[model samples]
Target chain A: MKPIGLKDLFVIFLKAGLAFGGGLGILAVLEEEFVTKRQALTREEFLTDYALGRIVPSGTMSALAADFGARFGGFPGSVIALTAMVLPAFTLSVSLSAAYVYLAGTPVLALLPLTILPAALAFIVAAALRLGRDITIPSVEALLAAAAFIGSLVFRISPALLLVGGGIVSMVILAFTERAENPA
Target chain B: MNPLQVALTIMVLNILTFGNGPALVPLLEERFVTMEGILTVDQLLYAFAIARVMPGPANAYVASVGFFLNGLLGAALAMVAIQLPAYLMLPLLRLHERFSDVAGVKRFTRGLTATSVGLIFASTVSIGRNAITSLTAAIVFVLALVMAYLLKWNPLLSLALAALAGLALHAAAPSL
Candidate 1:
């Protein structure tokens, strides 16, 4: 493997941020770019790595930065990857904070609550639909998703509980189904 | 509270909130007004307004509050505290790949992803309930959703159109 340099870090981070908006989808984007596009790893390999990224603590982007760096250029590669991934958004946030201190009190600010909030809601809904369509849910998985949605919305359950419950339910179903298919 | 305690609280809050920068708003508002005695409700709200109007992550807005309370070091500490989780977690996550082949683990990730989508939907419902105060607002919200889902419009463009619609509605019916 080639030594991962600053330029590689910058390219990966910029691409990850632009494609996935620096969120949960970073692994998918990275997989498509490096593994699928470059043919460095197979689809199965990429999916397994992505799954590992999610199960671990911390954000998916952080996991991707570390793993990708390690894969490309060992420990130093990991540093480059992580730095590139975070620097753009972190710098932008700091700069924006400086400007906000000046303009926050203006009456023009009221316009935003009336506009951006609604759009943000719409974005969330759209994201849910898009993700649901991508994942091939079996009947049991579908039930878990529906249950989690209702649990959060109607019961006003903590998101953490809903997530943990869904994970347990999926694990049970996956275990039973696998056993049925490969009984001794 | 002392600066060290404040810094620790901010760091823990940042990790718990999970989403990028916007997740810090409510937590900051509650802490700044109710606990820290650093800013009033009005000041916190104003900080929120300023944070949204300007670019960047919402966590940085807390630095503005820090600046108001204790000057340059306060501002720097607040920013560092909020961002430290991202910096620290990135390198440590490299070892995750060693368990990639585990079947049970993969199932858990799929479940978590689905649940995350559900949580996002719940949040959407709550935000929409608060934000769609008028028929015009509801219409703009629906239109933005349609543009995003059906027409594949860029989110920035949808946001721009919604803002224009809000401005027009406010002009047309000043009562709202």
Candidate 2:
């Protein structure tokens, strides 16, 4: 695939910005769009960018978009991607916030969110399932997931702590597994 | 709701979240309500609920909360502050190229990625407890799961159907 230009970056991120509901949940779709469809970024490039996004000190979606934009269009591309990535949600959020404040008093308005809630809930659940099938292949990866779920669910542990802990735990496991294999 | 305070507070919240938006909703609610008293708990939850209906990540809800606190300017400021970190850290992508291929980093990210997926699952449970209250709600949950995951329907459309179901359910069981 040829190197992507600023226009491509803007259009791609804008489409993503309009499509994703879950924050990190959009990574899979992004891989599909950029890697499989556009052939702009290879799977390896996307994975590296995604890992960088996870370790970076911002939102994963924003970090990934910024990195991809930088890759395609340098600093200006990053700016365009970030702006396009945010425009749709920002518009929707501000509009909804304003509307809710003015018009959410009626009984019908009250039930609107209640009705949307279940579907939204299920949406995330399905996303988790989809991501699970894609990422959690190894037993250790599965263990990390189970630990994360139980820790967050039962102990009220924060997700940040769980993610950090899982990283450390997986690192330790990898070290041990490698050592065991190379015991010469 | 001072704009500066709003900006600074949201900036700090984004930093604390470390880019994981959904995980911080409960914390966001507590602080917005109890610490600042800018919004009621119900109001905060409603803001989060409707956030799902929007296209961006759920964190875009922060913009809505900003609006709830102040208005358009507040929303704009909060959005910038929350998103600033990512752009600010763009230089780190260069550093990532140097170390991303290291074995331990690879292993650690494998863990983090899997764990992140679990966090998404937990988020569903958290939201499900609120949304799936009755048999009707359960049906919506199941129906949405099938439509979204198996049949590949647009999520917005599924949510629309759920809203109609909500209205119908309300009409049928007025006391509920």
Measured by lDDT, the strongest candidate is 2
Tell me the deviation in Å of residue A9 in model 2. Answer: 6.8
Q: What is the fnat of model 1 with respect to the true interface contacts?
A: 0.34
Tens-digit per-residue lDDT, B25-64, candidate 1: 3355445654566765434433443343333333345555
Off by over 4 Å in 1: A6-51, A70-77, A97-101, A134-138, A182-184, B1-100
- Residue clash pairs of candidate 2: none
Report residue B88 deviation for candidate 1 (angstroms): 10
lDDT tens digits, residues B27-140, model 2? 464457645777764456556656666776657778878888888998888888777788754667666656546688677777776887777676566556655667766766
Each prediction's TM-score against the native? 0.68, 0.73
lDDT of each: 0.59, 0.72
Query: What local lDDT score does residue A89 receive in model 1, on the 0 to 100 scale?
Result: 46
Q: Which stretch of 10 consecutive residues in model 2 chain B shows the poorest summed lDDT?
A: B21-30
**CA deviation > 4 Å runs, candidate 2:** A1-16, A19-61, A64-77, A134-138, A181-184, B1-59, B88-90, B96-100, B120-127
- Displacement of residue A69 (Cα, Å) in model 1 is 3.1
Per residue, candidate 1 scores C-alpha lDDT tens digits across A1-184 of 3444657766866666544333544565677667666666678766655555544344445655666677777777776766665554445444544555556778765565555556655655666677677566656666666776688678867665666777777877788888899996
